[model samples]
Target chain A: MTDFLYNYLHVYLFVALFMLFCGIVGVVYRRTLIGMLVSLELIMNGAGLNLVALNRFVSPENAYGTAFTLIIMGIAAAEAAVALGIIILIFRKYRHIEGGDLREMRD
Target chain B: MNFAEIIFLFIIAVTMGGAATAVLAGSVVYAIMGLVVTMFGVAALYVYLNSPFVALMQILIYVGAVTVLIAFAVMLVGPLYRRPKEWTTAGKFGAALGVALVSLLLFVRFVTETFPRAGAPSFEMTTKDIGRLFFDDLVLPFELISLLIVVAILGAIMLALFARGNK
Candidate 1:
C-alpha cells in the first residue's frame, strides 16, 4: 500500500479511474440534464488526469502531453457552455429540463 | 510515509469522497458543490505531477469558470433539489456497476505493474518546456480549439433565438 501510494503514476491513475467510474454511474442515474452535464465534466476531468499522469511518468521533459491535457480542459469548458445554452433553450421550450421531458422532436 | 505522501493520500481521499457526493447526492446543487471540491483535489494532484501551471489552470478553468457556469444553469432551470428518484431502479444501477467493475478489473491488472522510472519521480517541467507549449507545441491547435469554442457558443445563442422565435 505504501509503495503503491508513493508512486505518482499509480496514485493519480487510481483517482482518475475512480472519477471515471463515478461519472459513468452519475450520467446513467441522473434524470436531469444539468446533472448529466455535471457527470460529463467529471468524465472529462478523469481523462485529463489520466493524460497528465502518463505524461509525468513516461516523459516529463516533454510538454506535448501536458498541452493536450490543457486542450482537453478547454474542450470541457466549451462543452459545458454549449450544454448550458441547450439546457436554457430546453427549459424555455418545455418549462422543464428533465431527461424524460425531451421525448419528441416537435409538439 | 513522509509529509508529501500524506498530503497526496489526503487529496486522493478528498477527490474520491467529492466524486461520490457529486454522483450519488440527491440534488443537483450539492453535486455542483462536490464538483468544486473534486476539481480542487484534481488541481492538487497536478501539483504532484510537478506542473504548478497546469494545476493553477485546472483551478482557474474548472473550479472558477465551469463550476460557476453549471451553478448558473442549475439556477436557471426550473427545479433545484430534485432527488434522484429515477435512480432507485435496480436494473439501471446494476448496469452501471457492472460496467465500472469490468473496466476496473481490466485496468488494475496493468496498472499494478509499475514502470521503472528514474530516481525520486520528480520530473520538473521547466519554464522553457512550458514556453514551448505556447510557442512551438500548441499554437495552431490552440487557435483551432478556441475557434471551435466560439462556434459552439454562437450555436448556443442561435439555438436560444430559435427557441424564442418558435414561441
Candidate 2:
C-alpha cells in the first residue's frame, strides 16, 4: 500500500478508475438530466486526468496528451452549455426533466 | 508505502469518496458539491504529475466554470432537490454489479501492467517546457482548439434561443 501510494502513477490510475466507477453509477441511477450531465462531466474529467498522467510520466516531451486534455475540456464546456439549454427546453415543454418520467419521445 | 505515500493515499481515498458521493447522492446539489471536491482531487493529481499549469487550469476551468454552470442549471431547473420515491431494484443491482466488476477488472489490469514499465523518472517538465511546446510544435492545434470552443459556445447559444422562441 505504501509503495503503491508513493508512486505518482498509482494515484493517477486510481483516480481515473474511481471516477469512472462514479460515472457509471451516476449514469445508471440518475433520473434527472442535470444529474446525468454531472456524471458525464465526471467521466470526461477522468479521461483528462489519464491524459495528463500519461503525458507527465511516460512521454513528457510530446505534449500531445496534455494538449488533447485541454481540447477535451473545451468540448466538455460546450457540451454542458448545449445540454443545459436542451434540458431547459425539455422542462419548459414537458414541465419536468426526470429521465424516467419524461418519456414523451418513446414513440 | 512510505509516509509520503501514506499521506497521498489518504488524499486519494478522500477524493474517490467525494467523487462517489457527488454522483450517487440523493440530492443533485450535494452531488455537484461532491464534484467540486473531486475536481480539487484531480487538480492535486495534476500537481503530482509535475504540471502546475495544468493543475491551475484544471481548477480554473473545471472548478470555476464547469461547477458554476452546473450550479446554475440546478437552480434554474426544478425537481433538482426532490428525491424520487424509489429506485427500481434492477437499477440498484445493475449499478452495483457494474461498478464492482469494472473496478475488479481494472485492478487486475493495473497490477499486471504496472510492474514491467517502472521506468526511470525524468526531469520536471516545468511550465517553460509546456509553453515552448505550445508555441513550437503545438501551435496549430492550440489555435484550432480555441476556434472549436468558440463554435461550441455559439451553437449552445443558438440552441437555447431557438428552443425559447419555439416555446
Candidate 3:
C-alpha cells in the first residue's frame, strides 16, 4: 500500500497546478511591480515543476524535460534581473512602482 | 499510507501551503520567506522523484540565489512596510478566475491519466547521465543560456544607470 501510494504521478501534478493558481492570483492582486515579479517567478516554477513531473512519470528516457526546466530557470533569473532594474527605474521616475500608478504611457 | 508515504504527503503539503502563503501574503518580505519554505518542499519533491542533483540545484538556485536577490531588491528600492495598496485593477478579477478554472481542469486531467500502468517504469538516469546528456546533446542551449544571462545583466545595469541620470 505504501509503494502504491508513493509511486503515483498525481501528487506532483496537483502541486504544480496549485502553484500555477497561486501565481495567477498573485499576478492579479498584487499592486507593486516587485510583487508582480515575484508572482511571475512562481508561475515559471510551476511550469518547471510540470515539465519535471511529466518527464519523471510519462517519458522516463527523455532528458528533454529536465533540460528545458534548467533553461527555464536561466531565463527566470535573467527575467528577474531585468524586471528589478525596471522596477527601480520606474520608482525613481514616477516616485511610485505601483501597477495602478503606471496609467500614463504617453507623455 | 506507510511512514514514508505519509512523510511524502506531509512534504507535499508543506510545499503547496508555503507557495500559497507566499503568493497570498500582503507583505513582500513574508512572501520571500514563504518562497524559501516552498523551495524546501520542492527540493523534497525532487528527491521523491529520484533526482537528487536537481533537488540540490533547486534549493541552491531558487531558494538561495534567487530569493536572496529578490529580498535585496525589495529592501533597496521601495518602502518595506508601508503596506502597498491592496486593490487590484478592474479586469484582474476575471483573469484570475479564468486561470484558476483552467488550472483545475488541468489538474483533473493529470490525475485521471496518472494511473495507466501498474508500476514505476524501470529506467535509471543518474546525475552522470544527466551531465553527459546536458553537455553532449544540449550544448547549444547551455551556451546560449549563458549568453542570455550576460545580456540581461548588462541591460539591467544600463537601465539603472539611465534611471539615475534622469534624477
lDDT of candidate 2 at residue A1, scale 0 to 100: 25
Worst 10 residues of 1 chain B by lDDT: B79-88
**Per-residue error (Å), model 2, residue A12:** 1.9
What is the Cα root-mean-square deviation between model 1 and the actual structure?
A: 2.6
**Segments of candidate 3 deviating more than 4 angstroms:** A104-107, B85-95, B110-118
| Pairs of residues clashing in candidate 1 | none
Query: Per-prediction TM-score, chain A only?
Result: 0.88, 0.88, 0.91
Model 1: residues with Cα > 4 Å off, grouped in runs: A1-4, A105-107, B81-88, B113-122
Give the range where candidate 2 chain B is weakest over 10 consecutive residues by summed lDDT: B80-89
**Per-model TM-score versus the true fold:** 0.91, 0.87, 0.90
- Docking quality (DockQ) of candidate 1: 0.61
What digit string (tens of lDDT, one per residue) describes model 2 on residues A11-92?
A: 5766787788778777767777888888889989989998888776677656778777877877788788778877777877
Give Cα distance to truth, residue B64, candidate 1, Å.
0.7
TM-score (chain A only) of candidate 3: 0.91
* lDDT tens digits, residue span B25-60, model 2: 777878888999988888887776767888898898
For candidate 3, the lDDT comes to 0.79
Predicted candidate 1 versus true structure: per-residue lDDT over B28-106, tens digit per residue? 8888889989999999998877778889999999998999999999788765455434354678778888887888877
Compute the lDDT for candidate 1: 0.82
Q: Which is the better candidate, 1 or 3, if ranked by lDDT?
A: 1
